[model samples]
Structure formats: C-alpha cells, structure tokens
Target chain A: MMRRREARLGWLFISPAFFHLVVFALFPMGYALYLSFFKWHLIKDVRQYVGSSNYAFCLTDETFLHSLWNSAKYSLLSVPFGMALGLAVAILVNQKLRGISIFRTIYYIPAISSGVAIAMLWIYVYLPETGLLNSMALGLLGEHGRLTPMVASMLGKPDWHLASIDFLNSTQWAMIALAFMSGWGGLGPKMVLFLAGLLGIPQSLYEAAELDGAGRWRSFVSVTLPMLAPTTFFVLVTSTIGALQVFTPVYMMTKGGPDESTNVVGYQIYQEAWVTFHTGLAAAESFVLLALIAVVSLAQFRMMKSTLVGYATT
Target chain B: MRRKTWDKVRGALWATGLYALLIALAAFLLAPFVWMVLISVHPWNTPIPAISDLIPRGPDGQVHLDWSNYGLVLFDPNLPVARFLFNSAFVTLTVVVGQTLVSSLAAYGFAKLHFRGRELVFALFLGSMMFAGPVTQIPVYLLLRSLGWLDSYWALVVPGLSSAFSVFLLRQFFMQIPAELDEAARIDGAGDFRIYARVVMPLSKAALATAAAFTFFGVWTDFFNPLIYTNSVEMRTLEVGLSIYKNSYGGSNWPAQMTAAVIVMLPLLVVFLFVQRYFVKGIMLGSIK
Candidate 1:
C-alpha cells in the first residue's frame, strides 16, 4: 500500500515537467515534423502537403548548399582549434602553480560572455580606424599606415586599393570568423573538461614514462594524449554540434550579411522561418540539419572509439 | 642522482612554460572585457589603439575623460534600462524557481522512482535538448500568438522553463545519491514528495545550485528570444535593452556602447562570482568526468 501510494505521488510530482515537455517541446516537435510535410506560415497560414518536395528542394537548393558549406567551415575551424587551445590551457593550469586558478577563471569567463557581446567586442577590436586594429596600425606604421588605403574604400573614394581584408565580406572569412569566435567563446567548457580528464590520469603512467626517459612532450604524447582520448572525443562531438548550430552571433552581428556570405544552415533556417515566413522550408531544413548532425555524431562515435561513461569494460 | 637534478630543472622549465602559456591565454580571454570597460569609460566613439593593450588613449587631441556615458546609462529615464533590469530579474528569478522545482521533481521521478516506460521517457527528454532551439520558434510562437502571449511573461518564463538538459543533469546527480537515503526516508513513513522535499532536495542542493546558476545566467544573458518576442520597450530585458543603446549610439559609437555593455555585464559579473562556488559542480550529464 505504501509503495503504491509513493508510485502514485511520484507520477503526480513528475506530471508538471512532463506536461511542460509534452505541451511546449514534444507537441511542437511533432507539429514541426507534420508541418514539414506541407506549408504553413505561422502568421497567417493555410496548410498544404507537398510530400518529399520540401526535402528535395533543400537537397538541391544552392542556398542550402552554401549554408551547409558555411556551417562545415565554422565547425572545422572551431573544433580542432578550440580543442587544441583548450588542451594547451588545461595542460598549463594542471601544473602546481600558485594563482593559476585565476587564469583558469579568467579564461573561463568568455564561455559565459555569450555571442552578441563577444561579436560586439570583436567589431570594436576590428574597427578600421580609431578602433583597436587600425589605431595600432596607425601608431606602428607612423604616417603612411598600411590600412590608410582601405579607409578610402569605406569612403567609396578609390576602392581603398589595399589592406582590404573584410572578414565578414565574404563567405569563407565569415565562416572563419564564426568558427574562431565559437572556438574563443567555447574554450572554457572544453578546458574544464580536459582539466578533469587530466586530473583523472593516473600518476603511475607519468612515473613509468619518466623512468623510461620520456621528456615533457614525449609523456604528453605517450601517456597524456592516449589517456585523454575520451575527453577529446567528447569535446570534439559537442563542439562540432555547437559549431554546426551556430546562429546567435551570425544573426546578431552579421545577419548572414555583406551578401549572405556567412549564412550557415542554422541561420538560414531561422531566416526562412521567421524572416521569409516559409515554415515548411524551414522545417525541412531543420530535419536536414538534424540528420546531418546525427550522421556526423554517429560517424564520430564509430571513428573515435569513445568510451561509454559507466561501462567498466570499455 | 644526476637524473633527479635533470628532473628538477625540467620541472622548473615546465612551470615557466605553463605560466607563459597561461599569460597569453589570460590576455586573450580578458582583453575584450578590458577593452569594453575602457571604451565604456571614455566619451568618443573614436579608435582605440591598434595594440590589444587595455589602456585608453583619448583619441589624439581629446584630454578630458568622459564618464558622462556611464552616468547616462544609469540616470537617464528615457533609456529605462533600470526597468529592463527589473524585468530581467523578475523573469529570471521566476524561471529559476519554476525550473528548479519542476526539473528537480521530474528528475526525482526519473532517478529515484520506479515508473513504467521511464527509460523511454528519459530518452525522449534528452533528445528534446538536441532539438534545435530555434527550430521550434515559429510553431511555439504561433501557439503563444493564439494564446495572445507574445508580449507576456508566460511566453518568456514558461517557454524558458525546465529544459531536457537541466532534467538530465539533475537526474544524473540524483541517481548518484545513495539509495539508502530514499529507503530510510520511506521506512520513516515520509511520502515521496516529502522525502523529495526534505531529503532529496537538501542533498541535491549542489546539483540544484548548478542548474539554478546556469538557468539564471542563461535567462539573464539571452538576447535573441527576448529581442524577437517582446515588442514593448517596457517589456525588454537588459540584454535587449542594451541593444537599444546599440541602435541609437550606432555600433561605431564606442565608449558609450561599451559603457552600456559594461552596465549590462555588471549584475551578471557580481551574480556570477557569488554563485560561482556552486556553479563548478557540473561534471557533465555523462560520467566521463
């Protein structure tokens, strides 16, 4: 009787969250999948079923292709660089140094700074004149600043014949910027994870390596790298997802702009849904993105031999 | 003995190298905030020097340091950033409370209780977190629109509450709680909710704190949803409020916007440091840690 009462109470306790998920999350997802099979604008809508046509359009659309490529670019830049930077920092802070936690804390701050603010700050830093980058160029280069010519381009004068590297002007650099920023912002979580992995590494492996005449780099390779595979694998998968889903900064900062140069699939879906009012196309795009993420993650799992958490035998 | 000496030297070198690497990382991480503060304190939207150095040089000829911008953000009633703060705090606090209670209860059910289809339900919950947040915007908004909740707190607070990730984290931590506690609580004739409220909750405070802090920070710092959903100037959150400064001052209008950014970040900074002690308990939902 007591067990029965507890079970009843448990369901009662859990019902609110279940209700929320079912109402807001599960229902919307089902609706979205249903909506993807047809067309409906959320604003003033009629529903029309088009079967596989939405998927077909997404598959063939050059714009979709561009968005996917941009997303891939961002992910590529973010993952390897982000992981490398994270590993380097974690290795640094893992040592027995006083006040190192301050560095750890400071480095971790960016992870909380969010996308819009970081992009805003970067915009200031990259400002062509009187901004950090140009100002430095002016000071260092003296009178004939290398970036002075590009100033003309902004003025629409002589096309600022030189020193023109518009980071957001083209698709490639836009992706690079997104990737780099994502990496920069994401460095914190990965570093912390790597730090934990570093701590988990048994001291015996280090001692064995030291006795075998291995130096710092050699130990890092032979012991640290091998042991850290799990952490690296985890970081890579998450970062890959994060990079692929890049939206906030691109929307806030660039709006996929200077000519849709930086539009990643995530941003494209947002635009298609919200801006263009093409819910069906957006839903189809979302499914495609989900499929891509799933495939990539599964492939990674297969490739990396990542360990399951509680599985002692793995 | 000679090898020991070499090891000592190696250790010192490694220490030096570590410090060097850390210094560079610190500079990169701290540079933006430092620059933001500098720009905030100054008056001109002019160029800061090219070096990533934190010092503000008053754009060649200007001499007087302009702190008027900072004051304007605080005192200007027209800007109404203070109202934005109140709105943000209210919504954030509500969501934190609601999410904590709901997610923790759900977590308790999934973690401690024996329920049918628990594993399947748990999987569904986890999968929702991966469902692109933006994907549901239209459909969800349409529901809110029908309910006429576009500008209301429910749209902000309800949709923002109790995510799969939070549930997963709390459940993971709760499962790790010794089963003896629950069994003992049951033996003492405590009801499930009573056991949860008394024993489970107090024990799970670390996990609760982690979830609370993350949720608070997320709601407080979130820009997109608020920007899109809330139309009224009065309904705006701090993140959206700051964007007003962005539009007015123009992105190029430095010093002023950075001041606004600083103001936006100040509360978060304080709350972050205060809550940070509880925040670091996150070991990820998986046990790879």
Candidate 2:
C-alpha cells in the first residue's frame, strides 16, 4: 500500500515536466524525423509522403553542400582558437594577483551580452574605413608605418592598400572575420570553465610536483594538462556544437552575403524553412547536421578517452 | 646568495611579462565596449571620428556631449523600444519562474522519490538534451501554429517553460541534499509535497537561483525564436527588435544603434554585477559535473 501510494505521488510530481517534455521536446523531435521524409510546404498544408527524397535532394543541392562546408570551416577555425585563447587567458587570470576578478569580469562581459548586440558592436568594429581593425591595420601598414612599403613590394601589387581591405565585404576574409569575432566572444565563458577546472585541481598535486623538483613548465605539462582534460573535452564538444550552429552573427552581420561566403548550415536551415518555405528540406538538412554533430562528438570522445581515464582515476 | 639573486631577477621578469599580457588582454576585451559608449554619445550627423579621438569633439573644437542618440533610441516614434523591453522582460521572467518551479519539482521527484520506472524516465529526460535546437525548430513552430499560438506570448513562453538542462542541474543539486531531512519530515507527518515545498526548496536556493539565472540570460538573449515566431513589431523581443532597428536605420543612425545596443545590454549587465558570484558558481557547477 505504501509503495503504491509513493509511486502515485512520484508520477504526479513528475507529470508536469513530463508533459512539457512531450509537448515541446520529444514531440517536436519525433515530428521533425517524420517531416524529414515527407514533402511539406508551409503555406499549402498538404503533406505528400516522399520516401527519402528530401535527403536525396539535400545531398545533391550545391547550396546545401556549400553551407555545410562553411559550417565545418567555421567549426574548424573557431573551436580550436577559442579554446586555446580561453585556456591561455584563464591561466593568466587564474593567478594570485590583486584585482584579477576585475579582469575576469571584463573578459566575461561579451559572453553574457546578447549575441545580436555583440554582432551589432562588431559591425562597427569591422567597418572598413573608420573601423577599429582597419584603422589599426592602416596605422601599421600605411605608407609611413615602415612595414607598408615592404608589404606592398612583397605583394608586387602597387594597388595593395591596407586601408581598403574590407574585412566583412570580401569573400576571402568574411568567414575568417566572423571566426575571429566568434573566438573573441566565446573567450570568456571558456576561460571561466577552464578557471574552474584549474581551481578544482587539488593543490597537493602541484605541491608534490614541486617537491619532486618539477619546474613550472614540466608540472604544467604533466599535472595541469592531464587534470584539465575533462574540462577540455567538455569545452570541445559543446563549442563544436555551438560553432556548427552559428547563426545570429551570420544573420545580424552578413546575412550570408558577399556571394554566399558566410552561409553556414544553421543560417541555411533558417533560410530554407522560413525564406524559401521548404520545410521538408530544412528538416532533412537539420538531420544531416545532427548526424554530423554526433559523428564529430563521437570522434572527440574516442580521441579523448585516454585523458578522460586520467580524469576518472584522479 | 648569488644564485638566489638571479632567481629573484627571473621571477621579476616573469611577473612583468604576465602583467603586460594581462593588461593587453584587458584592453582587447574592453576597448570595444568603451568605444561603443563613446560613439553613442558622439553626434550622429557629424563625420566619423578619427581613431585618435577617443571622444568626439564638436565643430567648435570643444568637448560636446550629445545625449540625442539615447533620446532617439528610447523615444523614436517608430521604434517601440520600450514595448520590446517589456516583452523581453515579461517572457524572460515567466520562463525563469516557470522553469524553476517545474524543474525543481521534477528534480525533487527524481532525486528523493523512489518509484518504478524512475531511472527510465530520468534517462529519457537526459536524452532530450542531445537533440539540438534546430532539430526541433520546425516542428515546434508548426506545433505552435496549429495551436493558434503564433505571434503571441504563448508561442514564446509555453514551449520554453521546462528545460531539460535546468531539470538536470537541479536534480544534481537535489541529490546532494541528505535524505535524512525528508525522512525526518515524513516522521513528522509531512507529505511528500509538503516536504518538498518546505524542506527541499528552502535548502536548494542556490541551485534554484543558478537555474533561474541561466534561464533568464538564455531567454533574454535569445534572438532566433523571437525572430521566427514573433512577426508583429509589438510582439518582438529586445534582441530581435534591436536587430530590426539595425536593419532599418543602422547606417544613417550609428549612434542611435549603439545607444539601442547599450539599452538592451544594460539590464543584464546590472543583474550580472549583483549576482556575479552565483553566476560564476553556476557556470562552474554546470560545467564541472
């Protein structure tokens, strides 16, 4: 009798969350899987049962391929650089120096700010003539900055001007510029996570390393790096997922412009679903993305298995 | 003594290098924010200021502070900045409260109540986290449309009311609380709900606050949902509204755009300043386990 009553109460307690999960998450995911195999138009409301044609269409579609390439490129460029820079800064700010909290706060500000706002801010920062980056580049490589003539001569193009290199306007530099901004924006939270990981390492381990005459560099390589593997693995998986789904920046800043150079998979999915109203195609493309993310995440897990074992033991 | 002096000299060099690197990183991180503030106050109609001019000087060669950009952003007849702010605050608050309540209750069930199929249900909930947002985006939009909740607060709030991540986080925290308290409460004739309400919730304030903060920040900064769902100008959240504002008047009104950005970011920045420790702790807790 008591067990039955407890079971009833448990079910009652969890029903609300279960309802939400079914309504929002589980139902939608199932519906997405169903929709991926059908021909559904947003406006018409008539769903034709098409078997695997949407996936077939996505495979052959050049724009889909390009966007996938773009997303993969972005993940490749942003994830490693963001992790490295974040780890470097975390180590820097993790010191016992005075007022380190202030620096930590400033670094983390961008991560907490709205993505659209950050994109808006970066628009001005990346502005060609009067922007901060170009201005700095010009100062460094202009006629009087001493390196200007050498760079110009090396390029062997008299028209090569540092002031006119529009970071967001050109096809070659647009994706790279977005990657740089992403790296910068993501630095804070990544650093914070690393800082937490650094702090969690038992002080005794470091003391023992020092007692064994392990220098700072050697200890960092053996103790700090191994201990931090779990955090690094977590960051890698999450950031890879995040980078693949990069949308707001592309939407707010470039809108997949400059000859479709910045059209990542996430933005492409949005465009397909909303702009072209190809709901079925969009659903299929998202599945492809899901598959890719799963594959990459699995690869990361396999590669980092040894380090994770270290984490488990100590 | 001589060798110790050399070591001291090396240590001094290391400290100097570290400080220099830190200062440079600080400047890199903060300079853009400082520039945003400076440009927001600069006269909108004038030429873009030179890099050397951190603060713009008027044509009279005197320092002039122009508050017109802020005025334009806040009171522009077409923009509806205040409405967007209200919508964002309303939706964010609802999600924060609703998610915290629902997630905590569910967490309590998972953490304290032992019943049949408990582990299975919890595993299903955890599995839901693996499904990324885009995978479910279209279906949810369609579901909301069918419910006739499009372009309304229902579309924004209802779908986001319960988060798997929040439930997971709260469950982790709840499991750490000793079961003896609940057992003691049961001996005192308190029911499960009563124990949860009076005992578990009180002890779990930090966890609850952490969940609330994450939900608040996520909902506040979310642009993709608001962009896709809310078509009407009044239904728009601040992030989407600012993006629309940028699209329409960004080129001619750079200062006003910056002002609008500042307005959108100010509330969260203030909230973060007050609960900075909880925010960091939440990140640490969420990431570590």
Candidate 3:
C-alpha cells in the first residue's frame, strides 16, 4: 500500500514535465518526421503525399548545400579560434589575484546581451571608413599604412586593399567578420567552462611536474593539456553545434547577402519555412541538420578518444 | 641581498605585465558597449559622429551631452517601444516563474520519490535536450497555430514553461539535499508535498535562482520564437520589435538605433550586475555535472 501510494504520488508530481515532454518534445519529433514525407503548403493548407522527395530535393539543392558548407566554414573559423582565446583568458583569470571577479564579470557581458543587439552593434563596428574598426585603424596606421601592402603581398594580390574594407558588404570578408564577432561574443561562456575545468585540476600534479624540474611551459604542456582533455572535448562539441545554428548574426547583419556567401543552414531553413512557405521542405532540411549534428558529435567523440590514447602512449 | 632585490624587481615587473594584459583585453571586450552608450546620447538628426566627436561639445569646448535621442526612441508617436518592453518583461517573468515551479516539482519527483521507470523518465528528459529548437520549431509552430495561440501570450508562456535543462539542473541540486530531512518531516506528520515545499524549496534557493536567471535571460533575449509567433507590432517582444524598428526607422539615424539598442540592453545589464553570482555558480554547476 505504501509503495502504491509513493508510485501514484511520483506520477502525479512528474505529470507536468511529462505533459511538456509529450506535447512539445516527443509529439513534435514524430510530427516533424511525418511532415517531412509530405509536401505541405503552410499558407494554402495544401498537402500531397510525396515520399522521400523532400529529402532528395534538399540533398540536391545547390543553395541548401552551400548553406551547409557555409556552416562548416563558420565552425572551422569560429570554434578553434574561440576556444583558444577562451582557454587563454581562462588561464589568465584563474589566478587568485585581487579584483579578479571584476574582470570575469566584464568579460561575460557579451555572452548575456541580446544577440540582435550585439549583431546591430557589430554592424557599425564593421562599417566602412567612419566605423569604429576602420577609423581606429586609419587613425593609428595612416592612410597609406603598410598594413594594406603587407596583407596584399601575403595574399599575393598586389591590388588587394585593406583600406575602406567594408567587412559585411564585401563577399570575401563578410563571413570572416561574423566569425570574429561570434568569437568575441561567445568567449565568456567558454572561458567560464575552461575556468571550471582548470579549477578541477589538482595542484599536486603541477607540483609533481615541478619537482621533476619541469618548467612552467613544460608543466603546462604535459599536465595542463592532458588534464583539460575532457573539458576541451565538451567545449569543442558544444561550440561546433552552436556555430552550425548561428542565425541571429546573419539575419541581423547580413541576411545571407553579399552574394549569398553568408547563407548558413539555419537561415536557409528559416527562409524555406517562413519566407518561402515551404514547410515540408524546411522540415526535411532541419532533419538533415539534425543528422549533421549527430554525425559531427559522434566524430568528435571518436577523435577525442584517439587523442586521449595518443596522449597516454606519449 | 642583491639576489633578493633582483627577484623582487622581477616579481613586480611580472605583476605589472599581467595587469596590463588584463586591462587591455577588458577594454577591447567593452569597447563596443562603451561606443553604443556614447552614441545613444548624441543629438538627434545629426550625421553619424566620428569616434572622437561622440561626446557632445559646445562652441566653448565644454562637454554637453544630448539625451534627446533616448527620449525620441522611447516616446516616438508611431513606435510602440513601451508596449514591446512590457511584453518582454511580462513574458520573461512568467516563463521564469512557471519554468522554475514545474521543473522543480518534476525534479523533486525524480530526485526523492520512489517509482517504477523513474530513471527511464529522467533519461528521456536528458535525451530530449539534444533535440532542441532547430528540430522541433516547425512542428511546434504548427501546433501553436492550430491552438489559435499565434500573436498571443499563450504562445510565448506555454512553450517556455518547462525546459529539460532546468529539470536536469534542479534534479542534480535536489538530489543533494538530505533524504533524512524528508524522513524527519514525514515522521512529524508532514506529507511529501508539505516536505517538498517546506524543506526542499528553501534549501534549493540558490539552485532555483540560477535556473531562473538562465530562464530570464533566455526568454528575454529570444528573437526567433517571438518573431514567428507574433506577427503584429502590438504583440511583438522587444527583440523582434527592436529589429523592425532598426530596419524601418533607422535608415541613417544611427543615434536613434543606438538609443533603442541601449534601451533594450539596459535592463538585462542592470539585472546581471546584481545576480551575477548566481550566473557564475550556475555555469560552474552545469559544467561540473
């Protein structure tokens, strides 16, 4: 009787969350999958049974394919750079210095601010000529600054000009600019995660390395990197997933413009569903995105396992 | 004595270098915000000021800041900035409170109550976290539309009422509270509901605050959901409203745009300043688990 009462109470208490799961999560998953098999017009309320055609079209769609590629490019640009910068700041701020929390709080400002606001602000930051970045560069590095010539030579384009480089308006630099902005805005959370990982590292390991005459650099290379493997893996997977779904920045700043160079998968999906009213096609695209995330995450897990083994062997 | 003096000099130099790097990085991170605040105060209907001219000045070379842009953005006749702010604040608060309550109750059941398939149910919740916004957005929108919840508060509040992450975080915290406390309450003629309310809820304030802080920020800054769910200007939240404002009225009016952005950003910054401890603690807890 007591067991029966407890079980009943348990079900009662969990009922709300269960309701959410059934209505929002489970139902949506099955419905989206079902919707993927139909060519449904959201506005016209028209439906046709089109088995696997939506998926086939998505796979062959040039713009959709390009959007996926753009997501991969963004992940490539942002994730590693963001992680490195985050890890560096995390190490710097992990000290027990005076007023350290102040720095931590300031750094974290970008992470909490509204994405649209940040994107709007960055629009000015990347504006040509009178904008913050260009103006600052011009002020510090004169009109005929060697930066233009230097970058031109490095890229093997003698006429390539860094001056008046309208970052968001230029096809070549738009995605890169977005990547840098995301890196800046996302640095705080990654730093906090890495700091937590750093705090978890046992001090005795460092001491042991030091006792064996390992210098600061050596100890960092051996003890610190090895110990931070799990955290690094976690940050990597999460950051990659986040980079793939990046929409607000593209929507606010670029709208997948400057020759559709910045058309990320998220924006593509949005355009398909809402803008073009291709609801079924959008559902299929989202499933493809889900598949991409699963494959990427699984690949990361395998790569991390191999790296751990390599570290152990070394 | 000379060796000791040299070591002291080196240590002083190291400390100075560390501080200099930290200060420089902080300045870089904060530069955009500083610029936004400065530009928001520039006079209305003026050309986009140079970085140096952002701070207003008179003919006499005295500092004279103009807050007219802020007033214009806030009290514009055509724009419903006030309405958007109300929608954002109300929706965010409702979601925070509702999410916390439902998640905590479920967390209590998962943590303390004995039942068959408890672990299975909790595992399902954990697994569901992986299939967030992108996958479910279309179907959920269809569901909300069918319910005639479009352009309504029901659309915003209901979808955000329960989150898997909140449930997970609260469960982790609730499990740490002593079961002996519950047993003691039970022996004293209190039931599970009373024990949960009187015992677990008070003990879990910090955890609850952390979850609420996350919810508040997420709901407040959310752009996509409000954009799709609400089509009319009257129902639009601050994020979507601000974006429309920028595109519609912000052609060359940089100051007005900046002012609007600042208005949207200010409340979150102020709240963050006070409850930042919970933010840091919550993040650490999330990662540690």
* iRMS, all models: 2.1, 1.4, 1.2
Looking at model 1, residue B102 earns an lDDT score of 89
Taking the tens digit of each residue's C-alpha lDDT, what string does model 2 give over A1-314?
A: 99999999998988999999988888888899999998989878778999999999999999999999999999999999999999999999998877889888888888888888788889888888778887777777865555787778899986565555688889999999999999889887899899999999999999999999999999999899998998999999989989999999999889997999999999999998999888998999999999998898899999899667766787
Query: Each candidate: what lDDT?
Result: 0.78, 0.88, 0.90
Task: Give the C-alpha lDDT of model 3.
Answer: 0.90
Best by DockQ: 3
Q: What's the TM-score of chain A alone for every prediction?
A: 0.86, 0.91, 0.93
When 1 and 2 are scored with TM-score, the better candidate is: 2
Local accuracy of candidate 3 as per-residue lDDT tens digits, A78-191? 999999999999999997778899999999999999988898799989888878898888655535654767766788977765457799999899999999998999998899
Model 1 deviation from the true structure expressed as Cα RMSD, one decimal place? 5.0
State the lDDT of candidate 1 residue by residue for B94-178, as single tens digits: 9999999889989999888876667888788877776546457667877888899998888889887777778888988998999
Every candidate's DockQ is: 0.51, 0.72, 0.76
Interface RMSD, prediction 1: 2.1
Write one digit per residue (lDDT tens) for candidate 3, span B109-183: 999999999989988897678655578998999999999999999998999999998999898889889889998
Give the Å error, residue A122, model 2.
0.5
Candidate 3 chain A lDDT trough over 10 residues, lowest sum: A139-148
TM-score of chain B of 3: 0.95
TM-score leader: 3
What TM value does model 3 have?
0.96
